[model samples]
Target: MVKDLYPSRVNETSQIVRRQDPVIHNENARTEGPLSAEEIDFYEENGYILLKSFFQGEELQKLKQELDSTMEDHQHKEGPDIIKEPSSNEIRSIFEVHKDKSYFENLSKDERLVSIMEQILGSQVYINQSRINFKPGFKGKEFYWHSDFETWHVEDGMPRMRALSCSIVLTDNYEYNGPLMLVPGSHKWYVQTAGETPDNNFESSLQKQEVGVPDEDSMRWLVDQAGGRIDRATGPAGSVLLFESNTMHGSAGNISPYPRSNVFFVYNSIENKLEQPFSGKEPRPEFLANRENIQPIQPVSNKSTARS
Candidate 1:
């Protein structure tokens, strides 16, 4: 359901696109599984994997134009998931794009990503969420260090930690540009926090990435136990990172002159899917927790080039 895009050049369109299937076939890259055994091993042991120059040329360009439209449309609006920082036009995220737009929807369904999911989770995997996290220049807010699974498990009924966060860099990420920071191998230790989870809402989720911010002492202890090796993943625009959902990760506020943006997708195993919400209440909004469209993704080819 995308329009007027083919990978390069800035094209403008006012269209709400949809798609029938996910496409992994790339002209510049082969359709076979992209990750190596060593990479998989690293992801398993270190809790994250960063692949530089993962996608480029027309694909990146087309996605950027689509994001350009999204950023413009949702900057200060109120609807679905278009979340902005507390009192400003600076956006925090545009959630569940795969449900509405074709460009993001196709990328989320790409075979390259799903094949990796097949390796990590299983053959039957569906996306839990999809959104572009906007870390705008100068004024982007910070995300506290916490495990995503904590909130997913406690609030959204996710049963276990069998999920992963795959983030594709949209803008060049640098040390000074609010790069995502990860405490290596921190997923092994599930830290229990003292703080309470805020109510389920876009604002709450934006203000607090973690369900509960583990106290400083708790976070310090967890870091010490995890070997105290923190890694800030900084790379070019096309870099792709796959991180364990349980890994303790966060990013500082962006003070750089250029924006740091990424399209993030969370994939959860069908078998390790969410149980009922802990509150015994109805599940969260579909944009927040997608449990109904549990169908496994099927890989498709790019019927036409991404460029027009």
Candidate 2:
């Protein structure tokens, strides 16, 4: 059995656990992809990198079209994958996007993205999870601060921190639009939150997470460790934010008139395939944590017809 390096949701009191893995797996190697040595170093020191204008013009429009189609296709359908806002009917998120075998699947396989994943992870990677988050104006709910690795480790059986999330901006993400906020350098430490895993936690956690989150004290310490700096990932449409899996991040409720949306893809190294849940419960549904049909994606050329 693989040792659980980071444990959460098993204690009455929350504590900090130092990360045992490297943020950048292969720092010495020369990167053949888009990211430079300095960029890799930045991601190592901090937890995320916001690449502005990563996709613009026609390439970006295509993604937007796909996003629209996805929302429309599943607007009325009821399932665990389609999460709605707490107080409103607006769709909050659409999970298992890559499995849809549509434009999103192609986006996941694009060589530009896959190559970067391979570079940072230092191995072939597979889609651990994929989703599109929607935060409509005024009614969108806030996602509380928590490290994704914490939930994935305790609930979904992810074994290590060799994973990262890529958020492709589908709409303008202004500061007032509830853009993602991440604490710099917090990814180096894992926050073991207070709580025992309840049965079918994903059902409720998907809409509003109450468990597997850091306490106020833990959040304060993490912010102090980063010199009390929290970064708001604000950018125009077509920007991309790549963040570490263990990064402490969250977003506020959107009160602005503008809506915020983004496509999220989680890439996990093949070496870090999930096992039995560390929380001693059944694993989350495949839509949330994929266990079967897992295969490393090949890097292919960008297929968008219109060039930026």
Candidate 3:
């Protein structure tokens, strides 16, 4: 079934990757409920929302464990020096390693996450893509300011509409830790630049110098052009930032001692189709798999019965 999706791209010898179950068993943790009406309004208006303490305690620890294991697995096989330090160039292209069942299961089964996504993007959301971002200390690359959806549409021929992204901070994030930065409410303008590019360049330019590093003044000017509403998003471990794909955003290089890692899940309405496969290798099997396994948000039935 997976092979059929890639008419000309499939490698016959490539191993079949198993899909993860969409349920996680964490006895010590409780699920966080739906977002308040105010929270939903904030997301709709500003194009992003920082849910404080979104994941913590045991569940957070479990995710960290999984992240660590995944990192270690990659490091052992690829060698420690695969990523050198003190550069802000991020190591992109890590999907093969992220295809593990545990990673997908952990992300998909988060009840609170699904509830919040449903509230923001409706009940029939489809995960467009998922990948792990590893930003090594000092050596991590600086991601320039741009909209995720704009780059997607340009490169993959996808349309720009109703796209959403959820970034789960697997490690502690602060200004020095390469936390994501954004221009608040920039999604409303739908700005596009001539030479803007996506940050998915890992092997070729991952460690290369930024082609055009925007100076502070230039960055401020760009923010002003986008309406002068800029903000840096930083939070505790397990914090998640949900934003529209068109939100203008970027991240700095990690200046801290430790590497900053995060997992990004991009979702769009199921009816939306990608112009090309996310990885450019083959179509995601999950996109064609059983939709029942992927939980949909429960609809709100009665306003009168709703709790104040």
Which prediction has the highest TM-score against the true structure? 2
Give the better candidate number (2 or 3) by TM-score: 2
**Which digits, one per residue and each the tens of the lDDT, describe model 3 over residues 89-178?**
333434423235555544653555665665555445656566666776756667777566544554433443555778888777777777
Tens-digit lDDT string for candidate 2 (245-271):
999999998888998889999999998
Q: What TM-score goes with each of the models?
A: 0.83, 0.96, 0.67
* Worst lDDT 10-window in candidate 3: 19-28
Q: Quick one: best lDDT, which candidate?
A: 2
Model 2 bad stretches (over 4 Å): 303-308
The reply for model 1, stretches above 4 Å from the true place, is 1-33, 195-203, 209-211, 279-282
**For candidate 2, what is the TM-score?**
0.96
The CA lDDT at 79 in model 3 is 34
Error of 1 at 98 (Å): 0.9
**Candidate 3 lDDT score at position 307:** 21
Residue 303 error for model 2, in Å?
A: 4.3
TM-score of model 3 vs. true structure: 0.67
